[model samples]
Target: MIGTALRGIFTLPDLRKRVLITFALLAVSRIGFWITVPGVNYDVIEEIAGRQAGTWIDFIGIVTGGRLTNASIFSLGVMPYISASIIFTMLVKLVPSLERLQKEGPQGYRKIQQYERYATVLICIIQSSFIVAWMTSVTAGNERLVPNATFSFRLMAIVSMTAGTVFLMWLGEQITEFGIGNGISLLIMNGIVARMPGKFSMFISNIARAVRQGVNPAKEVTELAIFVLLFVGIVAFVVLITQGQRRIPVQQQKQTRGRRVYGGMRYYLPLRVNQGGVMPIIFAQAILMLPIAIISSIPGLQSIRFWFNYGTFWYIFAYVLLILFFEYFWTALVFNPIEMANQLQEHGNFIPGIRPGRRTAEMLEYILNRVALAGGTFVAFIAIVPQIVSSLMGYDIFLATILGGTGILIVVGVALEFVQRVEAQLLAREYEGFMRKPMRGR
Candidate 1:
């Protein structure tokens, strides 16, 4: 099945071209990963990053495809754009003027996009400035990452990093216009995947060290097996939840013209179980990082940082609540029951045993709230399980994270989306899809 899918993908000229363009653009993004910001000693930065493993920098590395560790020009990655979009999304829901603009259709959408771009630039500047300050301040063994903590160095770093992000944003747009899949998501997923081989090597070394120390190699092997099983089990569960949906049947009104019936048909609307998808997790993670950042910056607050530590009980509790909150918050903003009801009425279609206008809208809202709750609970569980495992098993947080947390979800989600996209293209060309065969066995 996999070989046939690959053959089908390469055989189609348009699809192949799009795929190639996507790879080329992603390669360009990766180039920035190796190009560090000037005036910084990367060796010192790398050592500090190693000592502070599993901190915010590592988390940033995970998000940006491992560029933060090197303090590269593209260290900011596509996060600023994502943050801007999320902010605008919230504003559109809260501000009546933006809401009105949103209802104006394509022209309104374009306007909103322009606003988002402006917001992205602003965010990039602010974040890059903070990074400059942090890098200049951090030192290791009398050696500083930024040797010269001058205003000129700060200015140069800010402009270079921000430009790198803007270029990445443009590259993502190009991929969206001329390539395949979502460009921003593809970049993130690419970064996460690029780190996998190194992570796998670390996993092996961890096991080998335990055995060499006579710390019961059999127990270590059992743990490895458990991790594998847990990873696979979680991935399977995520895929099921991600793809799960409820199909609401609708009946179209029949019309007669010259004794020929037209329009009478039954179709179903698919309401995804996980409506917010991965955004809720992203929002929750961003909000949860605030406490650590605050504690680290303040002198007296260092003692209380453990309360907000990643594996602490209070931290997990707060993280889960935040995830649940954002799940519902995002769902409410994007899914409009009233709008859907109106569209159904205009099309002369109605759900069976339900009225067309207000009642149908109410029903949809009720269903959405219930499904959103389930999704929120599932994601929250997935997010924290790895932390709990790491705390209990005394394993590295990075390893546990890749095997269990948002990283796997994003990776699996992107892979599924890419496959579905290729299958769609194949079907559009009247070719057998990845899972569909031309002939059936009797």
Candidate 2:
């Protein structure tokens, strides 16, 4: 099946070009991982990174595909650009001028993107400054991460990190323009996948250790098989949720023209079940990091932190609640039922049974809330699968996360989207789709 898919994908000249360009750009993105920023003590950074194991450092490393511990040029990754984009997305809705500009079509949209680029620069500078400050204060025993905390050193480090992120942003834009899938999403997916070799190595090492200790190799093999099946099932479920949506039937009002009647066509508006995508999970994780960091720093909080440890009951409970909350929150920010209703009415379109204006807005809002609840619950469950699997099955958290949670979610989501794009291209060019074999004609 996979071989057929690849053959079909590469057979198309345009798609093949896109696929190659995407891969070439992705390869370029990884080169920054080896190029560390200046003024950083490699030895101390490694030690500090070792100590920070299993913390948010690992989480960020896996999610963003960037290394912060090493003070690398690409330490900021595509996140700053993504953050700026999100900020502008909300601003377009909140600010009337931006909203109007967005409604103006391509030229106005380009202006908004220009604004987002400027915002990305600002975000990079702020984040880079923080990284520089963090490097100077963090230590491995007596050795500081930034041994020389001079103004020149700080300036150099900040500029290097910022430049790296800007480069990534440009690279992502190029990929989107010429490649098969979304450029930014592809970058993130590539980063998460880069962690795979290390995970497989760890898994193999564990098996080797068990064999050395005289444990049955058959038992290890069975466990591995079970893990693979469960991961496949989880991926299927995620795909189901990601692709699920409710289509509301819309009727276009008829228009009278002298002797002819026009319009009165019907269509559907699709409202996705998992409207939040991975943002809710990202928001939950970002907020959850604070508790993890504060627990060890503040005296007497250590005991309480035990209950809040990853995979604990309280941790899962809190994590689920946050995911649900942020799911609705993000959905609300991105979706405006009132605006949608207004646009529909202005265009002489209305839901089949629902009246236009206030009633339509109310109906849409109600449906959105119900859909969001189901989606949020599902997202929360998927997000915590790694913790549950690790805690209950005694599996490694880092390795399990690859099989579940944000890593798997992002990878699966990107793959599905990429496949859809390729299929669209193939269909347009009158060729067989990836999953479907060419039909036999008698």
Please write out the lDDT profile of model 2 over residues 366-415, one tens digit for every residue: 99999999999999888888888888898877678866777788898999
- The segments of candidate 2 whose C-alpha lies over 4 angstroms from its true place after superposition are 1-5, 43-50, 137-144, 210-215, 254-264, 291-307, 436-442
Give per-residue lDDT, candidate 1, residue 416.
Answer: 89
Residue 9 lDDT in candidate 1: 82
Evaluated against the true structure, the overall lDDT of model 1 is 0.84
Q: What is the lDDT of residue 20 in candidate 1?
A: 96
lDDT of 1 by residue, 202-286 (tens): 7678779987887867776777788778778888899999899978899999999998999979999988887887787777777
TM values, all candidates: 0.92, 0.90
Output the TM-score of candidate 1: 0.92
lDDT at residue 125 of model 1 (Cα atoms): 96
